[model samples]
Target: MEHSDYDVVVVGAGLVGAGVAAALAGTALSIAIVERAPPPPESPAWDTRIYAISPASVRFLESVGVWQALDPARIQPVRRMDVSGDAGSRVVFSAYDAGVAALAHIVESGAIQRALWRRVGAQENAVLVCPARCASLERDGKRWRLGLEDGRSLSAGLVVGADGRDSWVRGHAGIGATLEPYGDSGVVANFATERGHDGTAFQWFRADGILAYLPLPGNNVSVVWSTPEAHARELTALDPDAFAARVAAAGNERLGRLTPLTPAAAFPLAVMEVEHLAVNGLALVGDAAHAVHPLAGQGVNLGFGDARVLAALVREREIFRAPGDPAVMRRYERARREDILAMRLVTHGLQRLFSLPGRLPAAVRNLGLNFTDEVGVLKNLLIRQALG
Candidate 1:
């Protein structure tokens, strides 16, 4: 390979990376995706983990030329969202009330990434480099030089660190982050519900944690339950049938009995906030920028939103300014900082407020839910905010 300096070098070829790469493909810019792993989700199956993508995110993916490549049958649109509290405090959201056909769509994260990569691979100016690991990235005046582990070097006007939490690019670029573990573990699993979900996503606030049921295609749904690490381990370790029954019972048989379709898995829950999103000619996006709890299921959607805003700015500039210029990158950072901060604080507060060891919170929480349910305008406002 030659020492080619592309216009943009994006690290971490996950969904966010693919979005960024595909976004720049429309312009005359040269782009490269650097990753340690190849494409994932060799094929679509019941065992693949999924994500509940928002409508705005779907539109962005469509704009960048990825959504059409995804198999429509494999995706499930969420027509209704039901949220409740353990003490019988409950609130329900309908897409009809928000004047939309669906609240979100649940899709296999790997499949979407693979499909996006397929689109990105077809771009003439975009190069997909596998097993390309970044050793360090340093600012050289107006440009950033990326040194890779394969004993090769390249320089670009902009370097995007989509490398996820513990981003080496962000570290090398001198960006600091504040990370706090919420002492929660997000346990994910897929299941086949006894009855069709009718395109509804359900969530419950229990004493242990927040449990959400996102619809999958047909009679299946994806589950995300957050709780203490010990409880999460105990739950995931349960025999398949027992685990399924426990989940079904916890959710009050909303979709009836569930049979586990995928092995239960758990990842530590945390909220990470980066102090600086841009340094020199490098900027961070996706998990490299921030990671909130999975209760809201907006983590990946937020990353994709970052790609949309940042790329639009680059495409609109139409000047000699590099995509990675500090000024240009700051536009991306500033656009997303408020949204990220709001999500972080909201999720963090709810996790703590619900995790409290008392009855007062439980009582007051249900009241809060009831109040929100009563105020039609506030509920509508929240739906609009989420749409963005």
Candidate 2:
């Protein structure tokens, strides 16, 4: 216990990485969070990147202390959500029906990352290391040796690669990934609406893309347009007024008018499913472990879910096993596989079914939504399950 090296080392300083570090901070383990780039000196006011945080995720963040620190005014509660198809089929969910104040919140991605980092900053057992590049990972008996570009080396009982989609640790661990583009780009931005959102989020399953407007902190809302790269760029290039008009029309004028809040940009859509999440003296968490269709808005949530389960396992373990025990890591991976796999199938299925203009599948899909709408108990259960 007199070692200067950490007991646990977490790579990546984003939401999931920070959450994992903070989650393990309560334990006896000494943890370190490594990031290739240092966090922004000044956390930006807003970011084009957005995330739909589910209720479960909100509770987890609250448990970790970030929720209390976030400005109340900056958190947008989604009282209602409207979902529909281009075929004129739709359904709406109200917080009253769910008996919850909000189904979820749409917050700037940067805000949550900062929140987690801030929470982790208070951890007496965790250290934040940045501008550190990982050159190689060597697993010796019962431990890991982390080589960095800074001409320094550190040893840990466990090394976690929460790094990201393009993870050096995953490569170092010999884990393989299957990545493929969805032939689309997700164009994301915020907007000023003529009318208040009333805490309602809207999503449309269009033939060419999926258009969603998530209620923001103010009267504003954020838009995510997943469509062909050309269309995405075209929308991003539109002037404020023209863009607002076009967005309104595309949304069927659901929220009245839309105005860009941030400079919009298009990111190529892709999905990465890793073969396995564990390696010798190493385990993967967050984007380093899996990637899902963004259309579901659970990318980071899935990563956090990984963090939650992994942290629980480590904290509750009876033996003094390294953080990266293959047996223990498998338990973590197994705990998450069902949830992550279900989400992957659901998101992928929705994207494929809605993106196609078919006769029977469209009817079936629409019918399914309406069916779920009518079945109150079933719908609630499904929502709860989906949020998890």
Candidate 3:
């Protein structure tokens, strides 16, 4: 068996994992990224899998040299957002009112993934270990030894798990997680609107589900409908025209008539909480660390924030401290605790609040939305926090 060594080993090459490795570009640390599958090939057509990238996340990507590489023509800036409640209550947020360039940028997942993959693959200190699988993990003195199915092994002082919700590295490292399914699945697809979205994003909290129409470049928009499992099945089963009509009607045809631009897809929705973010020589980032409701569209941003902070801490650590030093892990955990807990509580609370089976509950929630909308300072505060 061939044996290799590295200062840090990142498991999973998803957006967060690749972001972490790319962020360490000029560092002295030798990093290894273990990915089981290769990145998907780019398509000329718009992708259905879209992300609302927060402003703060953009800065992190820029620092890692991934943002500049993206095609500007393909990106859409969200200048305004409109959220409505089932009882006709609404709240609006604008970048101008918040005094920012934009609230967030709508981007395709593949573009960022491919860009990060290329960036890290070209880095002198970063090694891309694709088409690889982890077979075993064990403590080898002060370092962690990761065994591959191909009879090759690598040793690293720090093992960062960016794998995902069901993180292999985290499980092997004895980290436990709590998962609560929302009894819903997010149905996603792209559409061409008769009228352009004008760089605005729209979301509605309905009796059946939560729906969001995110603007895309040109006259296109991406939609994510977090509906009950049964409804999700029906949505995906609908023909292109039927599906587009259903989606358009749900949003009150805010963007006018719609035509499907891509096939609809669905993914189960869940909220996950990990017992610990790090233990000894192992630390976790991205979905490996936590999972939250998608209503706020902040899950990816939170993951990117984890990568940015973790990389910065590793880079600025004391000379004598290893990448996985207890102190470094402690700081990472402490710094992220509040943000993770806050988001979890907010998303979970909202999901539950609207799930209540009473007209009174609906009225109260809708009234709350209207009240919040009337408060300028409160709305601006929310925009500022979300801008991060």
Q: What would the TM-scores of all predictions be?
A: 0.97, 0.94, 0.98
| Cα lDDT of model 2 by residue, 279-314, tens digit | 666788888888787887889889888888888888
Best candidate, lDDT-wise? Answer: 3
lDDT for each of the candidates? 0.85, 0.82, 0.92
Q: Can you tell me which runs of candidate 3 are displaced by over 4 Å? A: none
Per-residue CA lDDT of model 1 for 1-388, tens digit only, reads 3577888889988999889889888687888889889866466466446788889999999898788888898889898889898799888889999999888888888888888888888998899888888876777777777888887888888888899888888888878888889888999998999988889899999998999999988999889999999999999899989999999999999889999888899999889988887766677889999999988888998899888888887777646646766668778778888988888887777777888878899988888888889899988987776676
lDDT of 3 by residue, 139-176 (tens): 98889999999999999999999999899999999999
Q: Looking at model 2, report the run of 10 residues with the lowest lDDT sum.
A: 38-47
As a TM-score, model 2 comes out at 0.94
Q: Which residue pairs in candidate 2 collide?
A: none
How does model 1 score by TM-score? 0.97
Q: Number of the top candidate by TM-score?
A: 3
The alpha-carbon deviation from the true structure for residue 326 of candidate 1, after best TM-score superposition, in angstroms, is: 3.1
Instruction: Give the range where candidate 3 is weakest over 10 consecutive residues by summed lDDT.
Output: 317-326
What is the Cα-based lDDT of residue 367 in candidate 3? Answer: 93
lDDT of 3 at 17: 96
lDDT for 152 (candidate 3): 92
